[model samples]
Target: MYLVYYSVEISNLSENKQLSCFMHLQVPQTPTVIPQELNSATSTSIAVYWAVNDGDAIDCFQVYCMEELQASKDAGALVEEYRVTVKESHCILEDLEPDRCYSVWVMAVNGTGCSLPSEKAIFKTAPAIPTINAEDCTVCWDTATVRWHTSSASAESFTLEYCRQHSPEGEGLRSFAGIKRPELKVSLEPNVNYFFYLRTVNPFGTSEQSEAALISTKGTRFHLLSDTAHPALQISSKATVIHLPEKTKFTGFPSVLGELLPARGCHYWEIIVSACRSYRIGICYEAISQSSVLGLSDTSWCMRCCPTQTSSLYRFLHTGVMSDVCVTEHPARIGILLDYSGGRLLFFNAERGLVLFSIRHKFTDAAHPAFALEKAGVLTLRTGMELPEFVKHS
Candidate 1:
């Protein structure tokens, strides 16, 4: 039957009015990955280096010595044919000298073979700076303990001093000269904060002074704590002084011993003023220790001292980069001296592992505590027997 030919045909004539489901897909966000510096060193006629974050399919490594790199001959040569697979993060260059400087870099040899150099590092044998064995102190209490080794047994005596800032000239804060003993125990104050320093005095003008040790009066006390590390530390020649490119902060204190260099394109890096002592200044990535990378990040930091070949006259810095401030004028250096209880001096390097100097407890009483990183996030103090309280910060 021709029943109502009017078939109710719901024709899908709807073109744009269709209820379409869609997923707003977005790309994944990648983390901010900064290039990490490789830690390298020469051990027992072998050059040992390590990579932090190695990607997949590492093909081979490229080794360049100082000569190939056209660097200083004193810097030595780069290890060649040091190619190896990325089975592990660490790599080694056999048959290296203990008394030579080397620059080693790595390249990821992928399926396409070698890639560009990942990161370049500078390393040298012979300790970075002269270090001491058992160096320690107490804060807020008067007294410091210093021990040292001689490049030559004829090192004669040592010079000790304590001040609030680094001394550019050989003469630094509250100078104590020609002490025949390797260790010195001096009395400090209870109300003033002090920075203790030491230097090896020989026929030559005293080796660069040790980094300033930050201590406070009436802070932490020192008691006989268990010795964690060995007492002996290496001491070396005065390292090259690195001048920060940035001008001194308006709140920074000047060195009474020497004048500051003109600030240019500088920030901060770490260098060893001595074995157990290090200084802060505007160090560059090129001047990092080959042993450790402690506080180094993508951000730049200025270091005053470490083990390098910086001369004395050009060593002192008059300016510094303070947080949110620029120190044009120098501040007064007035602080009390005391012993540190149980604190270690830590330095940041790009190439080296984190370098540390242990100062033995010098107090007859309990061990006192030292507090750093209070100032605009810098290694404020280096060598001290005590930790001071109530710092007269400028």
Candidate 2:
């Protein structure tokens, strides 16, 4: 079968006898030229534009070298041979080498295929920002600490500030001077999370904060339970079972279908101690399963280790087993982890609640249902018959 495509035909009226119809009429894409005045680059602004012609439905857009566009000046480069997209057209490309020519263009694509490249445009990138490196944080505490860093050499001096991020709205509420050694130390809390902002000081004013980043101080050594599955949380086999002080709470209900369950329905057990010197808590079990194991009828409900005063209480409304241990140490931040092989394991965090940051891990066999509390402290195993490997508390 032969394929035929019809082009738009136009005839002028009042031409007398009859309007002559021309075949093989060529219709070009709308705009043949795009005009944009290059503006001064700043800490925040960048250039962005839409480059499509003839009202064609676009599939995707691309940016390519202008030289290629000039080589095929008639149309433009094909869809493939390019780099980068206008993903964030307003994205500020930092750390550019001074006085360099950069060419950028956008191409539109449709069902017919990729459209001709847009008009080629060239712009020079600004000079690189002066070099400067901040000092790593030294001292830390439960709440905050002091931090310092060097100023950019090219700058006469630098200004120091910090915020959760680098936006006009996020600009530092506070700023400090850095005139000597290019160093300045700011105070911070031990475990508190924060963001540090740095800028170069020239007569032109402060360059934007290098980049927005999140920084958390090291208050105490904690283990991470890694599992990306939703509503799933896991812990290293080495968390101590300390009694959360009275009034301790957990954030969310560790549920399978995202519902919190009754606290009284769950059993509460604490690690027993021969003496009173154990820092870590311990428990006894062959393996955690989805079935009638660990006295849990719901296979989805697994064991969770929670800190006494942490925000986890805000995530889940239900309470866990209120063992005497919770009345004792009252650890503030607790870690949740599990190994569910025959069944599934679901863990939740306070901020995310029934979602985000949950981890789950499945195991084939129960090698170590019982773990030695390496991080928390030592304790006597409670809740199961016949301790497997009992370690005496001093």
**lDDT values for all models:** 0.34, 0.34
The sequence of per-residue lDDT tens digits that candidate 1 reaches over residues 80-153 is 54344444344555454433445556554434444456455555432222354332432223443444554534
Give the poorly placed runs of model 1, Cα more than 4 Å off. Answer: 1-135, 146-152, 165-172, 223-394
Q: Candidate 2 lDDT, tens digit per residue, 1-394?
A: 1122555434555545454443342222422224333434433322445534444444455555322233324674453333555442223333333333445565554444554666666644332233322223322222222333433333545555655433366454576665444445455543345565556554323455554334444322221112210132223243322222233243432111111111111111223432322222212233333222221322222333444453222122112332221223333322222323223222222122222122232333322222222122323322211111111100
Q: Candidate 2 regions off by >4 Å?
A: 1-47, 51-54, 65-81, 84-100, 111-116, 124-130, 133-172, 175-196, 200-394
Which candidate ranks first by lDDT, i.e. highest?
1
Cα deviation at 253, candidate 1, in Å, is: 52
Question: Per-residue error at 271 for model 2, in Å?
Answer: 58
